[model samples]
Target: DAMVIQNPRYQVTQFGKPVTLSCSQTLNHNVMYWYQQKSSQAPKLLFHYYDKDFNNEADTPDNFQSRRPNTSFCFLDIRSPGLGDAAMYLCATSRDVTAQYNEQFFGPGTRLTVL
Candidate 1:
């Protein structure tokens, strides 16, 4: 199954607090990605780990960070979530080798609410 899974489909985070979101995949893919999306807008790539290589999008904020210690799991850390950070956090996975032609699989997403 080429499925990417994210836990806690909904999360309520406080302003200026830290939150971590998790993702796991059964696709055995070599790359995992984190994205931030808001109100039906296009998902913005935050970062991705292609095996041990970490690629961060050029415009990603410093407040966002990520880690992938193993092949199947990855974590997204948002430090001091602001009101602007109140959005859906999407976890995605793709095969590193076929990335040019293959599309990434996305999770159901964790909807973060900052208050």
Candidate 2:
């Protein structure tokens, strides 16, 4: 019954600047996921971690990078913020990849604005 947490609910950055979004969870879930959601569009899976293993979606841009130093925390680092990169970044956790229900807990999300 643990929860996911994201820091700095809102963020603003200048064009070409670097920005990072952070997420943490008390759930100790084995799988952690990062997603990008833009206005009027479904969330797109950027990457995920199963324990210490990192998995990035084939279409995920090189500008986006993630790090999970430990089980409870994950970070999304944007190397260069672009106008089109402004969106809601989400963090989710699940017990494991092969769970029967594959239920997940999601954070409130960090809204990034590129100026």
lDDT of each: 0.90, 0.94
Off by over 4 Å in 2: none
Write down the TM-score for model 2. Answer: 0.96
Model 2 accuracy (lDDT, Cα): 0.94
Query: How well is each residue in 1-115 modelled by candidate 1, as lDDT tens digits?
Result: 5688999899998999899999999998888989889999999888889897899999999999898989999999998899999999999888874749357889999999999
lDDT of 2 by residue, 79-98 (tens): 99899999999999999888
Where does candidate 1 clash, by residue pair? none
The top-ranked prediction according to lDDT is 2
> Where is model 1 more than 4 Å wrong at Cα?
97-101
